[model samples]
Target: MPVTRANAMSKENKKVAVIGAGIIGMAVASCLQRDGHDIFVVDPNEPGLGASFGNAGVFGTSSVAPMSMPGAIRQVPKWLSDPYGPLAVRWSYLPFIAGWLARYIAAGRPDRVERQARALRDMLGRAVDNLAPLVEAAEATAVFHRNGSLFIYRSAEGFAKDRQTWDLRARNGVQWEELDAAALRQFEPSLSSNCTYGILVRTNGHTSNPHALVTCLAQNLIKRGATIHRTAAIGFVLDGDRLRAIRTTQGEIPVDAAVVAAGAFSRPLSRQLGDRLPLETERGYHIMISDPEVRPKVPIADQEAKFVATPMDTGLRLAGTVELAGLNAPPNWERSRILLHQARGLFPALRDNYPEDRLSLWMGHRPSLPDSLPVIDRSKRSPDVFYAFGHGHVGMASSGMTGMVLADLIAGRRPTIDITPFRANRFA
Candidate 1:
């Protein structure tokens, strides 16, 4: 790949068009604007109100774990049948979802797992150092906080099973401390007596409000004079490897540079530009406790149900579950209800966690690749197009660093990490 003199000059003086105003999109927009590029952000909903809104708000830079692990593939059957189970897969759709499942299962192989782990560590290691400053630079210090996270297992069997993974975690430089039942009680007195074993990773962090962070980044982008338009991006105007303009619901916004950070919706948009990426949506639900008294000192991921409780500005946010349904499907509010139900299981006193789904509930589909890695490379099909989607469950964890990474690429500077591992055509 060669850096173009024209792109260098244009990036320094010409305009850029960014599709999606989600955290990933806005974060990239801010970075580009700061590095001296005019930007325009387009989205159908209000900026950040899509998948970026209502995230568990955890800054999980220390979390380098892959979604597919050694034992996860076997649990799909039981999970698919149970409503309140940790994960529920709709059995009827298994045929179509099987490709995703098969790919994920292949990732569970030791070699693949190890490789994916390294890639995740590369992204996460850069996230904390990169994201904190951006949060400050964007003037939203409240959005970034390092309170850490706790992973609690109710049974000794569960605790024993994961001890081996700690070695891999340690290899990635993530520090965690194990705690027995008594130690768990000592750490969080309010925790249910059933939480018998746990590990506390202090390197983790959380957001006060994910939506606030997204909006603040967009505001900063606007403050820097980036034009943000609300429109549905239909396609691209291509001239060889360069994208000439963006085809939107409103009109063709002539674009010298274009990036696809449209969350789960990135697939359709990317395909329209002649790029095919195996991106799937894992719809995660969050239930916020508006009652002021409800709170968790740090974000905690439940051992079984995959839910996590994070202390947000609103209150305590309990989010979890992965539904593989595609876009436009109504979120199963039943799943959100289950989050509320299990959150109470974590804390005995849950009188105020939000009375109904109308208040505390929110759902968003996180874009994920089967191997649990992100697409962070320039498109081979369109030299003017770049991909920054498929951060999967780690979007909140990796969004800001992704911005700097994108900035470095657009600026024609070598990235700090070997980006070849995240190439867009690796699936080939």
Candidate 2:
């Protein structure tokens, strides 16, 4: 179901508290403001500087495949053995995440994968179109780019191995042009000669600076009379089936309705509302090269390495990797460093040596569910309180549609898309 701006059932304005100032939170606040709601955004840190700050910046409209795909279980042992592989699990945290791992493997069943892909397509198919107005309203249009993205493979056999995944995308209405070695070079000459095959997804795009784009959206909300609370939401004060206020580190703030969009920290809040959902952090890492000798015209993803090299306003960002280490673990800078080695293989012209000052490394938590779908339904304890977190890797690309759907739910209107798959108690 494509997203559209449907009118609310009632025009009565409500004071809404949106917890978390990340991309998803800001987008929800913006959409609620458009519906004439008094918006209060709550977060201790500066907006968009969380996981939203360090994403690959891809619009990823064609990314309907779940992280746990068919035949994914067979490769987990290999990925875990390799320290520098795309996937790694901290041995100490295995006990904490074993239940999650079981569910993740279960989601890879062929039947489940098909259903998840359809639901993801419905939620993500028109992300850019849904976000265009918000980007324009924020006056941050310059940060947005629609140059499209390329997924390059190192060998013909490598491309052949991924036929099922590509077929899945095609079945879900994702369009792409297959490029052979010669055509791939003609399309993006900066790529390494070893890149023998490619899939050009024309519908995909990326942001030049994701942090700036989200900050601008937050600023726009402020200018339009929304309040920004520089405090963390600790709990909720509920009266029967309705929420009276949100308890925060600073103090309690009264609100007619509330949305929990606190990214990786949303599980505890949902637990307080009596829904103990299964959520974990997929710690992601990235490296930014300030001045690279070669820059791709569009974002290029190495199919084999599972990382994306995207041209950003600040620099060329090489972002990807999944570390199943819980929050509070020390930063593994080695994960970030591995991306630099992978980037050199994709872009041969890039300088082999760069000054220490020219490199920027970061690690952030991607709030993920085992099944790869977010929980977007109302809390079991209260209808005035809604849940919207666990977007995993697609949070940046799907934030706009998720916000619009939440606004519709809060305003007593049916969402344009069927949200049955995103129920909060599905795991139960």
TM-score, candidate 2, is 0.97
Count of backbone collisions in candidate 1: 3
lDDT (Cα, tens digit) per residue for candidate 2, span 245-329: 8999887888888999999999989999999999999999999999778778899999899999999998999999999889999
CA deviation > 4 Å runs, candidate 2 = 1-11
CA lDDT, every model vs. true structure: 0.80, 0.91
Best by lDDT: 2
Error of 2 at 233 (Å): 0.3
Compute the lDDT for candidate 1.
0.80
